[model samples]
Target: MTVFRLIITLLATSILGATEGVVTSNSVRLTDGETLASAMDKGALALNMGDVTFIAGYRQVTSIRQDPIIMRFDGQGSDAVKTWQRTDIDATAVDSRAVGLIWDGYERLYVLITVDGGSNDAGTVRRFTNNGWLRDYGSGGGPKVTVALRVDPNTGTPDTGTYIRARLSNGNTNSAVPTAIAFHGDTLVVQLSSFFSPLRVDRQRMTHDTGPSPFPWRVVFDPSLANARRSEAVNFDGVVDIPELPSRQVRLMVGDHEDASATVIVNQTVVARPSGSILDSGIYDPAAPCSFQLHDSIPSSLQ
Candidate 1:
């Protein structure tokens, strides 16, 4: 009877809400010469819970050296409750910076990190649980690697079976770092500015047609980070939740376009583009009034 009671208690805690509040924002406080990975805006709380606050930013170790650090605060806000820095965990000489933070709404805190891969950036994601930093996710108990880049030779598609973060393209002019990350239900959504085409140039740099551009890439992974469900380019602005909406589906705002039209994404697969007639002429603005019509098929122009 005691063993049966223990099992029931464990199951309840596994799926129960452990915290009273969970808040996340790109706006974070920074000192002189300090910067965030990709701050959405400036001057706001990064992440706060009840009385404790967490901020992800850089610490200037020296005039030439900077390291990523997460500062925790208690009541006073004058001093840090705890400082979780990257150098404290990884002692390597490689250049790494903590860019962003994501809360699973549970006990796990995912840290979005980027390491300098020669001239470009290589993305890596790690998690902190009750047991502390998970150092055993990699080979021989190394740091956890969330973004993997391994493509098949023939098909040129990501091969999941033998994926590794170390296999990502290095020494590229363009960055392969993850710019943003958010949780879409049980799935983890990560955004990369560019992935495969390292030498890709815009219209300003006129040249022969290079390989296809795999930019604005979005990748979805399960909770365990063992399998990648899908990886492809997307047109959504960012991941957000609509408090007024009744549905529980993930809301992805699609407001980045040349015209006065915007798209909407409820699931990772479907996309809905608003009609131009319904919107006034001008560039698409997320802050403006808008509506969308769900279609069974995506327009060929967008595809």
Candidate 2:
């Protein structure tokens, strides 16, 4: 038997932070009031809409309050795009943090949000059309509830209304929280997990079922945000992180173990293919091969 180990190390060569490069049209520069450093300090995220840049971040109002803000700047007039506000439904303890912004390249701009609902958090996907945000998406015009769908063997257009607001929760109110979200082609991949001690699924215990430990699971949704398909418990016992790949396939980092194993979910199918291992000090050991470092870099271009 051959074991494939995967390891990724992000290095920073600057004292300011880690630097990421994005090539955009010259017209897509930030206004004078905002700089790249300031955006990074605010934990802002930017998405390119046409030639313009759509920035999403939050402003700290009080210790327990934050206002989600969006800015549409094209080196010009008004930087304020729109202000978004949502009161907790049923007044049952709700807090939100912007996870990402998704644009369909035509009209819809989706905002991925995680709602902290005291005990169990939810992964909410909201849609903003050309007019404004769609408030009446779910029931009486709010977040659409999660439903069980027939898992199709292949992909096809969903037969339901466009899911302007979709929330992912599997009834486990104790800990089912959405940790991260990303786009796998046109499909949305959401990483979800509960609050419990995880039973590590290392090379030694891959065959045995680790029972009901908090191993991160995934839910894949189509472009409409409807027709969700859940995946099996990933063997690697860690929070799933979806990194960008040239192939645009969903890369699931196994866990923060020395083995550094990973599986790829291609297209919309849940498949695990172990990427090859590395030779560390000319010896083979599953628990001695993974290392990670985060470097926060500020771009000098100020865009």
Candidate 3:
């Protein structure tokens, strides 16, 4: 059997620290001054609406907290385009679940939504900025709750549109899932499962910026992998920083790669092996919780 390995080294400064938290309940309460209208202008309020939760890391809250309360934002303002209605959607009707919240160094908020209904397992990510909400591209037919957010090297801020990478399972007999994503400045590195093609890493520059008008997020892939439909892998249950790199590095694991196992290392280590091969792996940081259906398949070693 032949194995393909691709290694690329990038020169970058250490990664910045970020505030992280999760919202599992809808009991979050808001104070009198914490209405959506006021919070929108202040850009420093954390509110939870049903399955959606908003966290304002710019406010520099000493600690993260989710209170129980009912709050509403009535329509206001003449912008017409700017309605007081909240953009944080409640997906309970469809049985969707909130994975977690990530605050990048620039204080950009990214929310992961996992939809695991009788039909399919898929997900969507919403980026919250002072300007407004920016939705991201997502997959269908498989569980895609795993995600990773990296700072936009161009502006050094995520609001300007940070690099958002996600993975989903294709339910194929062969293990094909998005493995890892890494950002060094403006360049983005993405890894996915490829059946016929040789083992290789692809790079592309994409613009995730949004305007006042509604628009969907765009992802530009390297032309070489344009036909690589095997991007889907097992859902990632968690993410953590590689101790060696400490900063600017993260390891994502797919609990089970179709009975076999697999791992993707972004920035430093990128390896490709046949499906079902086992390798030494890192621990999953509970800080970054992901929603997927492969929980029962996680190897006993990783558990």
For TM-score, the strongest prediction is: 1
Across residues 197-275, which tens digit of lDDT does each residue of candidate 2 receive?
Answer: 2211120112223555444545545545444432323443332432222221122332434322432222223222334
1 against 2, candidate with superior lDDT: 1
Per-residue lDDT of candidate 1, residues 245-286 (tens digit): 111221322343222243442222222234432211111222
- TM per prediction: 0.42, 0.39, 0.26
Question: Candidate 1: minimum summed lDDT over ten consecutive residues — where?
Answer: 2-11
The global C-alpha lDDT for each of the candidates, from Candidate 1 onward, is 0.35, 0.33, 0.27
**CA RMSD per model (angstroms):** 18.4, 16.8, 20.3
Question: In model 3, which runs have C-alpha deviations exceeding 4 angstroms?
Answer: 1-93, 104-107, 117-144, 147-243, 246-303
Ranked candidates (TM-score, high to low): 1, 2, 3
Query: lDDT for model 3, on a 0 to 1 scale?
Result: 0.27
Whole-model lDDT, candidate 2? 0.33
Clashes of 1: 0
Order by lDDT, highest first: 1, 2, 3
